[model samples]
Target: MNVLVTGATGTVGAHVVDGLRYAPDAAVTAASRDPVTARERLDCATVGFDFTDPTTYRDAFAEIDALLLVRPPALSRVRRDIIPALSAAVGAGVEFVVFLSVIGADRNPLVPHARIESWIADSGLETTFLRASFFMQNLSTTHREEIRDGRLAVPAGDGKTSFVDARDVADVAVRALREGITGAYDLTGPDALSYAEVCAVLSATLEREVEYTDPSLPRFLVSRYRLEGDLAKAGVMAAIYTTARLGLAARVTDDVRSLLGRPPTDFRAFVRDNRTVWT
Candidate 1:
């Protein structure tokens, strides 16, 4: 089996590359925007590919049996970039596609994630949608500076979220890539924990008191740390925080267990494993 993984340098895509390396029968190809940095680190054959360019898709799709499509974060415009890849995959006779999508995307039109989900469903290709919740890696990277400063600042108000480990998401993606599963699986951690709970876990791991501070939405919206890139970007992040505040993302599921035959890793364990990031 030949598998092509897009966004190969990303957090989840990096793990996916590692997971695919163990499958001896599979020819793994890692596609990245910057091959010099991303390709050298990966064990598989690397190719130069960018989402915005249609010409890159045809060369990458050539003789590829299945694909793992991951959307770039903070990227508000995707249809123009992704549709060409989907069409190229069809023309290349690609068998399967595994998409890393956001949770509750179908119910939230405010988010562009739903639009991508719709595009995948209507593409006339066999696909497996891995709808992942917010990633715990966000704490280690995006919120790293805040954690180092001993405070977790956010606009999410008392909102509980089921954050999953990126490794687990990669495992599921590799399984779908190799086995060809055809359904949407909502991947999440074993428990739903509030932002405060996450801070507490970090405190325990770092052995320093960490606090969760609820900053005003208006203040953050206009702050320098604003993640808003465009209309879709701003609206999507707002919907995510809104969903968290409304307790929409608090549900825990056994989809990870069903797929991997083991329970999903909890948040505390993730913190303990990556304590150096917090310190």
Candidate 2:
């Protein structure tokens, strides 16, 4: 059962290494600080882990039994040194970890996602916390230049968001790393719209006219782009329009159809299945 999928070519760690590629006896291992862009987007066998080199995580934790941990959205290079290189890979034996937390992670402390969910709930290994949401592939990776300039612009006014499906949060983080489950799963989306109903379902799945512009959370964090640095970005534009002005990420949850049996894909089927990455 050797997992190890930390941001291995991201967007839910490339669908948790393509849903653990049918796990014949599970052995995935695609950690990455670019083993040539995780071996050109991960077929597998790509290493070089780099949480700013905690001596490259003992050759990416060698026989790494379980890990799927992806908390690297930069936040000043993981608030200065990747949570002690993920608590020194649970003191070098890295048993089970799965964390990809978000969605008001235990009430966002200026969003380092509640300091990486309190360092994976005080890391003593065996954790789960997937908690994902707000990622309908950020309309083709980080709001693709405001959906290629048609403007689904910022400061999220109506704020509601249940948009989940990054390969259904990588098939529920590869089914909590092949069934070692544990806790915290808020992985949303079966519908909870309102970024003006997700720009009226991306203007009817890219028929055009995609405009949801609400400008002032520090002027949409100075015109957002990878939410520009210096760590506050107006406290992530006042916690994403105060989670859509206190609708609190709307609601809608069957916990991804009770953990991926089905039914989590809407955002108008993720804009008619990625509408050519927003026209």
Candidate 3:
């Protein structure tokens, strides 16, 4: 299998690239804007790919059998940026596509992932959609500084979220790429946890008191904007947390265990494994 992984250097995508290395039958290529850096970091075959640049598409998709398609967070205009690239992939004879999508994207047409999923399905190409839940890495990466400072603040209210590990999501994605699995799978962890419960786990792992400041929507928007210095990005994040606040992100599923043949990693296990980030 000749697999090309887009967003190959990102959170889940990086792990996907790493997992594909051990798949004997798969020839993995990490697609990046900078092929040189990607080659050095991932130590794999790479092709320079920019979604906005049509010229880069030909070589990126050339002779590729399967594509691990991941939408870069910065690119929200799917029709303008993603659809063209996917069209190019089809033209280049790419047979299978494993799209990394978000949970509830199928029902929510407002999100860009839904549009991409629709386009891929309409393209008549064999595809698998891995609709993953909230990533546990968010705490370690996006909210690391806050957690390290002993406070975790978001507008998630008392609603619980089923956070899945990026490593597990990557494993399932690799399996889909290699085996050509068809159908949508909702990948989530074993339990749904509220922010307070999540903080408790963090406290246990780091041996320090971790607090969850359940800020109001307006307060969250202001704080996030102040932290990120981008109101647009902050607004997007607020919307995501709003969904969590509404209890829309708490669904747990057996797809992870069914796909990986093992139980999904729990929040406590994830925090324990990555405790150094908080420390």
Q: Each candidate's lDDT (Cα)? A: 0.82, 0.75, 0.90
lDDT tens digits, residue span 195-241, model 3: 99999989987899999998988998899888888775676677678
Show where candidate 2 strays beyond 4 Å: 3-50, 75-132, 135-154, 158-160, 163-171, 174-176, 179-187, 195-214, 222-255, 258-279
Candidate 2 residue lDDT tens string, 1-279: 888888778778887898786788688978887787677767678888888778888888877878887766654345476787777777778888888877766765656667777877877678888777678886677677677678777666776778788788888888888889888878888777778777777777777777887877666666553456544545554575676566766666787788778788777766786788767
lDDT-superior candidate, 1 or 3: 3
What's the true lDDT of residue 165 in model 1? Answer: 91
Ranking by lDDT: 3, 1, 2
Q: For model 3, where is the 10-residue window of minimal lDDT?
A: 231-240
* TM-score for candidate 2, residues paired by index: 0.32
Off by over 4 Å in 3: none
Clashes of each: 0, 1, 0
Better of 1 and 2 by lDDT: 1
Clash count (model 1, backbone only): 0
Error (Å) of candidate 3 at residue 50 is: 0.9
lDDT of 1 by residue, 1-279 (tens): 989898787888888888888788688889987777776788678887887777687778889998898877656566775677677788998978899987777677666677888887888889898888889998998779878999987777998999999889999998888787889999999999999988888888899999998777666555523543454445556667777787778878899989998889888888888899867
In angstroms, what RMSD does candidate 3 have relative to the true structure? 1.5
**Which 10 consecutive positions of candidate 1 have the poorest summed lDDT?**
224-233
Candidate 1 error regions (>4 Å)? 224-235
